[model samples]
Target: MPDLPDISNIPYLPSPARDMNWRDLNRFKSSDRGSDFYKTCLDYSQVLWRQRLPARAILCLDRAWGADLTGDEPILESWPLPYQALVYILQNAPTGVFLGNPRIHFQHYADRLGEPRLEQRKWRSWACWALSCKARPDFQSDPDHDVEEPSLEKIAQKLDQYGHIEETKLWKSILQAID
Candidate 1:
């Protein structure tokens, strides 16, 4: 988190409005990699990501995709690719690069959220993959959905099925470290 400019020093406590700019966030000077403001924002994001339920998290994705993070187009747009990659890869759909924005098929995705398990993240990952898969040209969308709970079995099935093609490539990269 970078240093937050001293707004407290201002004479008037209230202002009608303040224009926010992202350039401030991008500004990096020398070793000023982690500013108070930047670290705060990342901490906020991490908290939000961690505490969020699967359903709510997906909904947040929807709102952000529909509109920039929280409103007027950001001066510096946020990249959702990392978020998307985390979601799809966890579900073993590493090739979901073709999955476009999930807005157009929101209902379809919201429906396929499967069941919840004690291990909550599993269903969220699967739901994320379903959304990603729906966008690919070949992976046809299916509305017949179920709320089946996710378990170790479910996770293994998804990995075995969807991860097959990428596993060899993934293992090759992993093996590189040994040599």
Candidate 2:
């Protein structure tokens, strides 16, 4: 059998927070408990694109989105800034963009977390489409277009479908990513 490529070999940029001005880092550190801190983290995550960091960018973006959904703070600012930041990162990342084929990454993480097959399949599909769309030209030009606006009905349905399981956390994070 051919040996599978090691996922760990993928290169990621170091966290920009390490190199940021102490004031900025202090803001992030202080805001960590605030809802807006996650969005700030997302903003910092944008630095990865300019620095050619892919894996780390996605990981941080995911973390930021996770914090956003946990009622960290209302995304008070318009989506354009964060969206553009993400687009820029996706475009420049060394992994050829699209965050490493969302289907594969999502499934790999899901399996590692011991998620059920059905839930894993659902998330994989959702994540793949979300990540793939990030590479579209329209995504960059029209920051709002790629976002999958979740209606109350959709959110409620998701809550109903996966809320009881630990996967709910993952689903919530996915919803944030899609937003």
Top candidate when judged by lDDT against the true structure: 2
Q: Compare the candidates by TM-score and give the number of the best one.
A: 2
- Please list the residue runs of candidate 1 whose C-alpha ends up more than 4 Å from where it truly belongs after superposition: 1-48, 68-131, 134-179
Per-candidate TM vs. native? 0.26, 0.42
Worst 10 residues of 2 by lDDT: 6-15
lDDT of 1 by residue, 1-179 (tens): 55433212111111213322335334544234322333323332333333322233334343222221221223213332123422432233213123333432443444443432212233234434443443333544444544543443454455345432333233233223221
lDDT of 2 by residue, 102-143 (tens): 333433443344323344333333443344354433433223
Candidate 2 Cα RMSD after full superposition onto the native fold (Å): 12.7
lDDT of 2 at 122: 39
The residue ranges of model 2 lying beyond 4 angstroms of the native Cα positions read 1-33, 68-72, 80-88, 91-102, 110-130, 133-179
lDDT of 2 at 109: 45
Clashes (N, CA, C under 3 Å) per candidate? 13, 2
